[model samples]
Target: MKNFVFSEAVVMAGLRWTIVLIFMLFGLAKFAEYEAAGVAKIAAHYPLFAWMYPLWGESGASNVIGTIELLTGAMIAVGAFSARASFVGGLMGIFTFCVTLSFALGAPAFWEAGYGAPFLGSTGQFLVKDAVLLAACFAIMVDGLRRHTAP
Candidate 1:
């Protein structure tokens, strides 16, 4: 039982690192003009996020998001050793995915109508992956909480 539990921990660590690398790479990409422009188009459609355009413009909003991703990734990486840090990182991940997933609703032609209502188009395919990422974040949150509370 103990060995099995330990194995699970090892697997979760690998998952954590995967999410961290994702954050790092995507965070870095946010700094580019093309990436910034793309995100701006999406954010412009999101009512909750649309206000950012007026306040910060495209580049500024993207930079802010990139900074959040970088910070969240750093925290999760440090979480390899610290349960509390992982908890915080998990929270950040939850928030990050929540926003991105919302993008799917308003994204033009997100559904591949040729197949059916449930079938997804190219943009939907990309956005749907966040559901898995969101689940992983939840697992990280639970694992971190468990580790922090354990004697």
Candidate 2:
């Protein structure tokens, strides 16, 4: 096996930073409620998340989820204890994507409940985006694991 070097580690850090930046920006937007109205609009398209609006309010849930996203993003970017951070972030990404997919799939049924037409298209787009993000997370996790185990 090729021995790991500092240069490889730096490259991994850069990759992690790129992923973190994207998530950070999106998370910050949600936290500031900058896209709340738009999010609320799109969210309406997916009736599956209707309960979220009622439970946390459009802005509230946005803020809470945003905060979590921001924290995780920061942790990944910093690369401090990178292995743990990568593992957590990777797991979170996978979990979030799965949950969102579940919601998206159920959206049609939710709409039949009188919520209106499902935004299956937008939901599909969201799934695609998350899948990409999940892939990035997995890559980071793998890089981190390799870095940690390297001599």
Stretches of model 1 off by over 4 angstroms after superposition: 1-6
How close is every model to the real structure, measured as TM-score?
Answer: 0.91, 0.67
How much lDDT does each candidate structure score? 0.87, 0.66
Candidate 2, residues 101-145, lDDT tens digits: the string is: 565555434343434554335445555566677777777767666
Tens digits of per-residue lDDT, candidate 1, 1-151, equal 5665558878998999999999999999889999999888777668877888889989888888899999989988888899998899988998899988988876976898678568998778888999999988888887889899999
Q: In model 1, how large is the Cα lDDT of residue 42?
A: 78
After superposition on all CA atoms, what RMSD does each candidate show versus the true structure? Answer: 2.6, 6.3
